[model samples]
Target: MATPDALAFRFFSLQVVRTESLGPSLVRVTFAGDDLAHFHSDGRDQSLSLFLPAEGRSKPAVPFEEGENWYQAWRELPDDVRAVMRSYTLRALRRDPDEIDIDFVLHGVEPGAAVAAGPASRWAADAKPGAEVVLIGPAVADNRAIRFRPAEGTDLVLMWGDETALPALLASLESLPAGLPVRAWVEVPHAGDVQDVVTAADAEVTWLVRDESSAEGAFPALDAIRAAGLPSARKPYVWLAGEAGRMKELRRHFVGERGVDRRQVTFVGYWRRGLTEEQLREQPQE
Candidate 1:
């Protein structure tokens, strides 16, 4: 098959206009720029890189470059080098001359959470109006082209994720076929961590608490899902995302044991356990 245009993965720059708390653990930052008019809306999960200044410092601005070396400079950056580049999802897009809003989930004081949280959180916490930040790639669309064509009609769609995957999950939910039924299975560490999600689709949402399960291999939430079983043998589409190892296990259970058609599933490794933000992109996906 012919490949999609290279522009599909392109990015642009924007300045933060404001920030607000989504919950105790999430930050919503709104940005706008003339370049956003060119933002691509390919209906796939998109990612971006935000550069943040080191702690105990004023915001720093990097001049945007229209060349490849800019990205190289970012990648080759060494630690102990104050500046940082963090990766995050583009949760929503607006195209009235290029303005977009992105949400960054905060890490609190946890070190592991910091790897999943990025410059977006850093900026959201401390950035001020007029602060400039460059938005990186929408990062090449998923290899699998998704079509919402009503082939094997179904009564519902099942969606699940942890805090790490919430942004993408939220975006995906908004794009589902209008009136299609959906069931959301979300697992968050704390009760206050949950935030209201805005989606037009018909959905039955459920939240899971981590303490209810064992230390490992003991997910009562997942078990609940397994017990509930697939929506139907007609095969409802399933979406799974979160930490790399956890997502892999869920994928195996869903595909290996349940025998769901591979084409009807969208499983993603949003991050890996113990990997720093910079190390996350290097972890390969299956």
Candidate 2:
């Protein structure tokens, strides 16, 4: 996989170096490669596109066309022959041996699972040290994909995310300056999904664990935020990412009800309720 196409972004040939079970529904995969020597990112909420090998393929088939033409060329390949593409956020980046960590939400891999696991979930669940994957990532430390940007003189920070967005949420939280007033809410399917949040900021984190019987997990952050009183702030920045529809509702609560400036609120739709990643990719971005 060689896509030296775009200037800021390029393809990095990588393989799994280790895997760690973060919880019942989450797995953290660490990848390393010689190409990673050029990988650079500021890391907070940094997005990357991963290409995984199809069902019986040994390696992913990616087009190397320059500029945006690579997308069309990739789509032109046969469905079974093309790579399975998915989006993920960089959980952490390291030097010394040059590696990156990505956390995957194991959708339907467990026994008696309600939903069927997708290609990425299945691949992640069974990933071994030598499993290969390609990453379309930033070559510049300050690329446009890093979205958690707080304006100057921000007095307080507000954040919310679901299991799918946990990696990005945690990365963003860790990047905030020490002593900044922060409040965060995260929703996950199982109680085991909750992890200790370590940040230098004066932060309060609330975890919402949905019943195990619930398949997709209920999003209660909107109602929770609506009912609770937020800390007083001259200027507050809000960051919210999770399901598309739920994020819209939270964005409304923050801007329409809480009276936070629309410009100061940043929201990302990590996934939709029922749509597959491929299906969601076809829909225009919200």
Candidate 3:
């Protein structure tokens, strides 16, 4: 598979064309823009950063004309005017219509609580046709951030993801070669969040419905993975992404307890339990 280029980021102004609910907690939003002609995705687990305008605003006021160094410009803006930026995977890309589909997890408001909703989730839940946003993505198809590169002669694939990483996991499953041995586990909040995933690969996917009543810091999926034995294969590639803390423990289990070669595993911490993406990024890397 082709790899993405390094440091290739471009800005595009896109408008929402349609919206659909994929499951109980997932919303699919299709965006279209004339500038998308230059947008090319590497496909498997490709991700991009999005800038959403504040409520009641038609479009984000980003000073893109200041050139590729928009990050500094975005930061220079006053707190109230600056847009809220977040990262998300490109669920699907269609060049025919010059559009892209993004799946947003709908974290509904808590009943009888005064807590503020997540900016991205709130925006997605209320997003409508013609809603405009800005995306910092790749101009070329092979730009990096795809991240699902398996080495040659790999015999089996092991995957695990939480609801936040579901889009990327599903995308990778759909692209695997036919009849390839694959086992995947996806954990979601409810059984209704499970959706039929179409893939050509001979893959067995287990849906792990989370127990919300459980005490904090519980790692049910990690426990389940520890209880199950890995499939026999000469060379197995493991890919893991989800909550940061849980993923760290899983990495230890696979590399230390299971004796899997560290080089064969690709692990990423998509998010942390208590920290927002911004806060997570601020901390030193582990």
Point to the candidate with the largest lDDT.
Answer: 2
* Candidate achieving the largest TM-score: 2
lDDT of model 3 at residue 229? Answer: 71
User: Rank by TM-score, descending?
Assistant: 2, 3, 1
Better of 1 and 3 by lDDT: 3
lDDT tens digits by residue: candidate 2, 1-286: 4444467898899999999999999999999999999999999999999999999897888886554677888888999989989999999999999999999999999888878899999999999898889889999999889999999999999999999999999999899889999999998988999998989999999898866565564556766777777789999999999889988888988898889999999999988988988889889965
Please, what is the whole-model Cα lDDT of each candidate in the order they appear?
A: 0.66, 0.90, 0.85
Evaluate model 2: give its lDDT. Answer: 0.90
Task: Give the root-mean-square deviation of each candidate in angstroms.
Answer: 4.4, 2.5, 3.0
lDDT (tens digit, per residue) of candidate 3 on 1-286: 2233434667899999999988777889999999999888777788898999966677887888877566799889987788888889989888787999899987754455344568888899889999999998888777667888778999889889999899999998988998988988899977888989889988999899998789987888888888887778888888998888878888888889887788998887878877888898788986
For each candidate in turn, the TM-score is 0.79, 0.95, 0.94
For residues 1-286, could you state the per-residue lDDT of candidate 1 as single tens digits?
Answer: 2236544555466678888767666768888877776665554356566666655545433334425455566455454444566766767776654667777766653465534444546557776777766665543444223222223676667777888777777777777666777888888777887767677778777888678346766766668777764445466677887877776677777778777676777777767767776687666645
| Residue ranges of candidate 2 with Cα displaced over 4 Å | 1-5, 65-68, 212-218
Residue 235: error of model 3 in Å?
A: 1.3
